[model samples]
Target: MRSSVVQLAHARLLIVGGGAGGLGAASKFARKLPQNSVAIIEPSERHYYQPGFTFVGAGELRLADNQRNEEDLIPSKVKWYKNAAKRLVPENNSVILDNGDTLTYDYLVIACGIQPRFDLIKGAPEALQLEGSGVCSIYLPHLAEKTHREIQAFKSGNAIFTFPAGPIKCAGAPQKIMYLADEIFRKRGVRDAAKIDYYTSLPKIFGVEKYAQALDKVVKAKDITLHARTVLKEIRLNTKSAIFDVYNAEGKPSGETIESKFTLLHVAPVCRPIATVSECSSLVDAAGFVDVDPETLQSRKFTNVFAIGDTANTPNAKTAAAVSGQLGTLEVNLKAAMNGKPLGSKYDGYASCPLLVGGNKVILAEFTPKGPLETLPVNQAVPRSVSYLLKRYIMQPLYWHGLVKGYWNGPTTIRKILHFGRSN
Candidate 1:
């Protein structure tokens, strides 16, 4: 145990979690505010491009390529408190740190990302640790590497992928890995011997209708088995089996179990808000996400506080692209509050997910609350090789250099220009 006085520090603005959203917010505020006015609370040494993990699992990119030292990416003017938030005291405008320090802020931004709960499923944590267990996941950095190894070693038997029953970051990721695995098996001349299955809790392959229709064709053409409304209940590592509880038409458990034996099992575990956000009952909704006005990104109760990225209770796909779109809204609202002005800007719940159908193809699904808000004028529902190239070459560099530096705010400008000033 450690002991120290609860030292207090004050900041003009405090941002939690130094992930994509936090870094973007920091860069924007650091340019406008005085030196040390903005403080970011993040304990991790390295910042990962979480969107790249699926590519790493597919053996297309190395794990190290997606990581950078946390300090290097943070703006020089902002203070970086090398600590994790333990509790959020919204009433006092203070945040308690694990190291016995209290930070009080005039304004707060909760960007703390989602936490993957492997422990939620019985035998999952232990099964993930077992050697040669054939259980792997791309959601975690370490497990992503393990998934690539499992793919390379697989010679036969079932290759199963799962999507849990909840709102998850990058909703397209569960099927992306399945398609990559299919391509890998075909290239290895073992496609016939191995059976590929995608088990998801959602009734549809994707949320957007246009993209879901296209994905349906891809699923059929690839001959991948689709199991809908099936939730993984447990993993039997010793027997290499995955047990699922089937759901009826009324969305209740059917009291029936489906067991599948696998040589490789990839799981996208259930995700929940981090402890700091979840435990703050007054600050969050019933789902443990920060309760904010969706369009304004402002807290309903505390006018000085806001949330962005996966932590915000917005009905948008929790992707890095969503964070990119949210940056502008959060910035405008926070600055408006500081200046005692009404917030004029509103976010349209924009989000994008470049669904990697295979190594060479991608369905660039971009949408807002209304419908598909594509950047290009062409029909984007169909999978194309150029989209895959864009995902590989364009997005990564833009995220590291432009977004973190506070320049990129999604492709809204490009979309407007391409569509002849059409808002949709």
Candidate 2:
């Protein structure tokens, strides 16, 4: 056993993930403190840029562009425990790893993010396990490889896309792929043979009223069927059919169980924070998400703990762009706490979702916590090729290099300069 004197330096700060938030947090802390003062616990061999999955599904970007080897991303000075954290023992100021190793820290940052629960939808896991089930998803990096093949080969019959009944990273992703499928079919001269449909459990096409109104128009104009409050019940890949339950908004049961034959089915599974975090009911909210103040991104219970990315219960739409915003606030507040000072940092609740509607077009949705109506000066509601270029090529690199390196602090500096300090 390692000696306690040399075990962990008392000033040690532990970050629970190696993803965007945890990486950014650790990078900032490493720059602020001594070499032995920080440690990061993560199990993944590689880190991924999740937002790129949208473009991957559209066949506009390759999955290779979004991944980074693990060793390269983590700061060299900080110690890394290559294991998942099973429980956060904040009372002891320590974290228990899956390997039974104990790590004590003066501060902790949780950024494990969300896990996609494909099993929640009946038959989804088993059916997707098959080599070629005509079903594909863009949620996992490895699975992103199969999307292009499935989409390109879809020639006729129903091409269906689904949105699950919960918060998800990049809320615009579900319909984005549907729009891409529509454009693809039209280009192949098989638009008439393809019955393109979008089924969402949400009440609207998009979350913000302005964006939703705009998207409703686009979906109608594109001839893509949109059904709300409809949930996928099962995937019958062997029979080339899917089962769904449609409900009326009034809580009245609609007896309609949809049975559709599909040549292609794209699903975005319902997601939740890893079960380990969710098990601690006090740390999470009603939906099993880390409960943090919308502005500060600090946990209500434990002041030392801060959360970012999809795992946090902040009302803002889950996006890496939002994590960029939260990272700055967390860094500032954490520094303040360490110095025995007050936390004056506040997040503007800013998040942006790049909706890749087709090969070279995207609808950029940027908004804040107060409301989703506010967006950038550009045509925020309209689909444009310019936005696609930024999202597909520029954003991923910006995230991995600038954001993770603690150089990018959201677009606050840029937004402030643009708004003349009038906007939040």
lDDT of each: 0.90, 0.80
Clashes of each: 0, 0
Error of 1 at 398 (Å): 0.9
Worst 10 residues of 2 by lDDT: 1-10
Q: Write the per-residue lDDT of candidate 2 for residues 253-367, one digit (tens) a residue.
A: 3888888888889888888899878887768888788898878887899888777888888888888888888988998888998888998998887888887766577778788
lDDT of 1: 0.90
lDDT of 1 by residue, 34-99 (tens): 988998999998999888999999899999999998989888888888889999999999999998
- The alpha-carbon deviation from the true structure for residue 268 of candidate 1, after best TM-score superposition, in angstroms, is 0.7
TM-score of model number 1: 0.97
lDDT of 1 at 87: 94
Alpha-carbon runs more than 4 Å astray in model 1: 1-8
Structure candidate 2, residue pairs in collision? none
